[model samples]
Structures are given as C-alpha cells and as structure tokens.
Target: MPVQATSVRAPFDMPGILVPDFRHSRRFQITEFGARPGDKQSTSIAIARAIRAANAAGSGSVIVPAGIWLSGKIHLESNVNLHLARGAILRFSDDPQDYLPPVQTSWEGIECFNYSPLIYAFDCENVAITGPGRIEPVLDRWKIWSARPKLHMDALVALYDMAYRNVPVADRQMAIGQNNLRPHLIQFNRCRNVLVEDISIRGSPFWTLHPLLCRDVTIRRVSIQAHGHNNDGVDPEMSQNVLIEDCVFDQGDDAVSVKSGRDMDAWRLATPCRNVVVRNCRVLNGHQLMAVGSELSGGIENIWVDDCHFVGDGRGGDDHAVPINNLLYVKTNERRGGYVRNVHMSRVTATTLAGSVLAVETDVLYQWRTLLPTYVRRLTAIERLRVSDVHVQQAQSVAVIKGERDLPIQDVRLSRVRVERVSGTPTIVENARDVTLPAAVGRNGASALGADFKNSRRI
Candidate 1:
C-alpha cells in the first residue's frame, strides 16, 4: 500500500519551538583560511581556523564552498553557522587519532569524555548547520568499532557501574585503549536555538543527529541514509521544545528515537524530555518508525507526531520493497523509572510492517539483564496515548501492548485505523486498562487477543 498525502495539524500551539534565524550573519569562507580542495593534506586545521574566526566575529557563518573538503572535526560555537553550499562534500578522516583528547560526550545516554563528534557544539547558543550539500564520514575506521568485543562490553559494564555509584561525569573517561565506543556524527550538547536543514548524511559512526540536553532545536528537510550498527537517524535526548519535520530516513535502527538518560544517572539529572513535535516525515526503512526508548528514566511527555508516511516491505529491493519493523514502538524496562504520557499520533500511513503497527512493552531489556545489575527496579507509568487515522496495508499484528501486572498502561485509544491484512493476531493486550479499539478491528478472521492477554480491561 502506498501512503497518501494528508493534512494533519499539531494538537496545540507550541510557542517555544521556532526555527533559528541566521540570515544576517557574516560569512567566513574556509577557502580564505588556506583550505584547498582535492588535496590529500588534512584540512582540519583550516576548518578549525574558520570556525574560530567566525566565533570571534560574534555572529557569522563559516562557509564551505562547492568542493570536496576533508577534515577531522568541525566544532561549532555560539552564533556561528556552518553553511555548506551546493556541491560541497565534507568528508571526515578515518584515523581515530585525528579526534584525540576526549571531549565531554555521551555514549548510549551515559556521560563520558570520549572522541568528539564529527560536528560538535558544547554549551553554545544560536548555532546552525545549513546545507544544500553532503556530509559523509570515512566508514573504514568506524565499521571496525561496530563489533562488540569483550573489551567493549566490559567498558559498557564499567560505565553502568559508575552511573549506579553516582560517579562524576568528568571522571568517567571512555577513550581507553581499544574501548571502541564510536562518537556521533553531529552532537549539540547543552545548546539552545539550534537548526540543521537541507543536508544529505551518507554515513554515521553512531547516532546521526544527537541533540543532548538542548532546547528549541529544529531539524527539517534533511535526508539521512546510514546503515551502520546502532545508527539511529536522530536521537533527541533530554531535549525540549523541538521540531523535526519533512525529513527522510533510511536507517539501520529506529528512525526517530526519543530518550532521556538511563537509570540513576537520569534520575539525578531530573530533566524530562517534553514538548516535542514531529510532522511530515517519511521513513523508507527502519526498525521502528518512531520509538520512545529503553533509556528514558528522566520521564518523557507531550510528544506529538503527525502526517507521516512509512513505505517498506521488509525486504531489500526497491523503495517500496524494504521492510519497516514497527510503525510505533514504545519500550521501557524495569530499571527505568520514567513516565510516558500524553503522546498523540495522527494521520500516519504505512505500506508494510514486519512487526506490529503499535507495540508498547515493559521488560524490554534484551541484553542488559546479563550485562549489568539492575540498580533500582521501578515500574514505569504509561498512559494517555491516542493514535488516530492510521492505515497499514500489511502487518504482523495491529497492536501489541504488554505492560506489567502492577502498573498497567492506561487510557490508550486507537480510532479510524484501517488495516488491509494482518498475518498474525490482530491485537494483543496484556495488563492494560481502557484500551479502546475500533469496533471493526477483529472482524474478518482477526484475533483480538493472543492467548496471553490476561487482566486486560475495556478493550
């Protein structure tokens, strides 16, 4: 089934979410800073010089003209815009040594000082990465780090232990020998008024666009096709007042994964990710069209997704032949103490789904059970989710909601959903309350419950 164009609007007026304006900023060209195209020499020094000059000028743009530019890291400062004109290709170096001297970054929601992201901004405001060009990383060096060797797993365990023990973030350095924790492609840490638009991202070492502890961020008209391990298209962690619209994602993981921190660390941070809106997006292939994570211990609320189209067949052939796992997936585990509430999605259409159209589960800690000890067991409260006007052509199931017996998901409503074919059970509800589906859901050989929906009420 193909997705049709629909007019869907945001549920409420969000005054805080606005795009950054860099129209009158001055321009600082990289070519003037001794950066030459097609030269095998490293352009890291020149690019850094351009950024430094732009930052010193108080408000300006660091321009990379139409050419193939090679660099190591491109760090941004407040009031500086990194603009890539047409035909500009910014390629990153493959050597790990080029990104030496660990910077303050987060690896899987744990704060640590690791290699800097390819494009990083720390504690900056009014920054942007405007582009009509391409940004790609040399994947030969990063592909090796994707493997989870014993050393990598051990480092993850240690990181978790430190978080459980309340160790300072500065003391948790993860750039040890052969640790292999990859940095993200673009990370804006503790920044405000950020904008990224019109860019085509080819490869990513980790999460493609990570806005950590940021506010008033806007990402629009961007195309991302990164298929590495754990390469989620965009990870909005501990951020607020954000808008992500009109983007194309063909990812190896979730297209848009909303997270905060994890466990004790998140509990201490105490910043819930809230007031975010995503609309007019297209997902070609991904594990989930939209996911609210396994890393949300700091709470997540007020999320709105509207007017999105997902086209995939779970196979690898043409544009409509690829397969998306789930249309909407909300995952949390026993260790997370967050609350997910007030999420509304409307006017979503999908072609084919490999899994359920909607999946809400607790106890989804696939590998953390054996890797680290659960410091605190907290039951997450999930409530007030509404999905409306959704059409799925083919799927394994229409909905699968698995909540804990003690803390059941409450007040979930699905209306105007039209599913052409469901191979498996139509809906499976376990430990939930007030889950109201359309009356025509289970007609025509669709099993509403899987044999395990016990204690579910009002379905």
Candidate 2:
C-alpha cells in the first residue's frame, strides 16, 4: 500500500503556477495523417504532420488514440498540446540516425548543438504533453553510448574548455561522427507556460523529464520508471516557478535534482533555479528522494519539499528491495560556486535509508576530480536549511553535516525528526554555525543531545 501524505503548504505564494487548460481545443488525429498501429514503419513524418496541422489550426491538440505508435523524434510547436488517450503507447526508435540534424540542446548543463530529445520543444509558449499513456524509448542503441570511453571524456573536456573560454553556443557542436552523446527523453528549452500531466514514461535515453531555462511549469500526476544510466526522474535546470506534485519516481539516479547549469556555463547563463516546490510525491526507488546539486553553479534557493514518502525498501517482492542512498542530500564541491539557501522539507516519511536522514557535504567531487581541471575554485555558501516533522524507519545515521573549514554552513535546524533504528553515529556535525536539533531522535529512543560536534559552535 502507498503511504498517504499529509496536507502540504507551499512556502511562498505560487502566483503564476497553474495547470494549462485545453478544454475547447480542436483535435488533429495522428491516424488521419497515415499513422498505423503496431507497424514497424517509422511514424515520425505522420506525427510531425499532425503536429503541424494542430499548430496551423491555431492552438489545438494532436491526439494519439489507443495504439502503439513507433516514431523517431517529436518536435512540439507553440500553442500545441500532444494528448494521448488511454492505452496509447508511443515507442521511439533506437537508431541514432533517427534524431539527426542536431538541434539546440544541452549536455549536462553545457549548451551545445546535439541530437534532439525524444520529445523536444524550443522557445515555445503554452505547450503541453498530457495523457493517460506511456512514452517508451527503445534504448538498444543508446545503451552502448552509456560507456564513457576516452573519446567521450575528451569531448567533455572540450566542452568545458569552450565554456570557460566563453565560446558561442552555436560553435559547440557535439553530434559529430560517431560521437555518442545521449539525448534527454523530454526537454523543454527556453519555454514558458508548460504543463505535463497524467503521463507514464519509461526507458529513457537520458534524463527523463528536463525543463531547461523554462518558466511557469507544472508537472502533476505523472509516473516515471526509467532506470537507465544517468536517468534522473525530473531535472529542473535554470528553471523558475516550477511545481512537481503527486508523482512516482523509480529512477536510477536522484529522483528530483534541482540544478542551475554547471560551473562556467552556469556562471555565463546567470540564471538561478528558484521557487520550486515538490509535494505529495512517492519515491519507490532512487539514489535520493531529493538532491540539490553536484552541478549547481548558478545557485538554488527557495525550495520546498513537503508531505512526501520515500520507500527505500522497495514496493514489491524481494527483487525490488533496493535501499535508498539518502533521503535529503545536498552536495557541492569547491569548484561549484553557488548559494543554496532557504530550503525547507517537512512531513517526510521514509523507510530503509542507507545513509543519513539529512546529509550535506561540500567536497563531493564524484568524477570531476579526475575528469576536468578546476578553472575557478569558488566555495558555495549554504545557509538557512531547515528540516522538520520527518520520520525514518531505519537509517545508517540520523544526520551528517560536513562543511568546509574556510566556508562553513550556517543556520541549519532540524526539528521534530525521529528515526526508529540507527546503526551508525546518530549525528555528525563539522564546520558549521548556529546548528540546532531540538527534537532529533535515534534508535536509543532518546534525543540526540549528546552527539559530538567538530569545529562547530553556537549549538
């Protein structure tokens, strides 16, 4: 049974965040454009025709009714809504040649001309992808691209150099011959007033749902179960006024990772991911329920996660039992110069957490340590992080907050947090200031009043 979440309140007024409505819109059917069900023929041209007809009709829906439609890529236009009826399945082709003529897309926060995402929209307004249907990408070819050979690493290094040297985005073309850079499943780039609701997504080539530099986005009642490499469920990068609610994430990486581009590219963009809210969500399995960076260089602020459930021990039989790495994780390194502040999480319930309930580390350089040379070392400023009313059934540690000696984390508070079983240290604090844990509990059925602190003061 799924755990029921309590009522959640948004931290700030979400004025412009509302679901887009298409009640009286006209419908352009894909079948009318010669699309057949279950045929091995590519439906790319047919779907594209249908979208063009819808767009030409002035704000309408391109309907895909109850069938398995195989396609290569889908490019959405302005004032158009792609709607799938119940039992509709849109399967994408796995061949790399299908998504040709690289469009304006990004590879891990660095802007480049790469292969288009499976469903892509660029600089459009009032666009949506809504349905009670499934969008699956056949990854037989993409899975091979997952291997990061020296060629891939060299390409990455080139991108980093170009970013630091302030190269024009048009000059950074990554889709050369035999260069395997995976594309996102769905990406809305520089779009406004986007809505994705009631959709089921599976088998992504890369990050599942990515909204880059978008504004006023709402993703509600969606289900994503993609476990491919680098398949983060939802990545809102450099986006603003976003809301993700009542979604289920069974991912291979962080469920909801809020990023603002990466180092030099991010500094160049100068757009912080701000005013995002995630509520009433369920994490069946993921690396973390919510993660705030390893790539945040443009800063992240005013994030709220409330009334969520993270079932780390899986939701099915024995094969499904994978413990979550952490419940709430904030990770940044010295090379990432950003500010993380005003983050609040409340009424979260979890079970079988492999790490601490809350873990914040500053020097978490996963592959960048050996991958690229640090161009500028700017320490992040993390402050005013608060977690409240959280209950964890089991965890390795209650909390671990590690900050840099030169730049300490400040004003962190954990209140009304309880853990049933803790097998490791209850709390570990270092290089912080004004840290307070009023109701932090552990396996001993007592408050964490005796935990040791290192280089921290004003508890």
Top-lDDT candidate index: 2
RMSD vs true structure, all candidates: 4.5, 3.9
TM for candidate 1 is 0.94
Regions of candidate 2 where Cα sits further than 4 Å from its true position = 1-9, 39-42, 315-322, 445-447
Reference-based lDDT, each prediction: 0.84, 0.86
lDDT of 1 by residue, 97-213 (tens): 777788999988788889989899999988899989899889898999999899999999998888888899999999888888998999999998889999899879999999999
- Candidate 2 lDDT trough over 10 residues, lowest sum: 1-10
- Pairs with backbone N, CA or C atoms under 3 Å apart (clashes), candidate 2: none
Clashes of 2: 0
True lDDT of residue 66, candidate 2: 93
The superposed Cα distance between candidate 2 and the true structure at residue 175, in angstroms, equals: 1.1
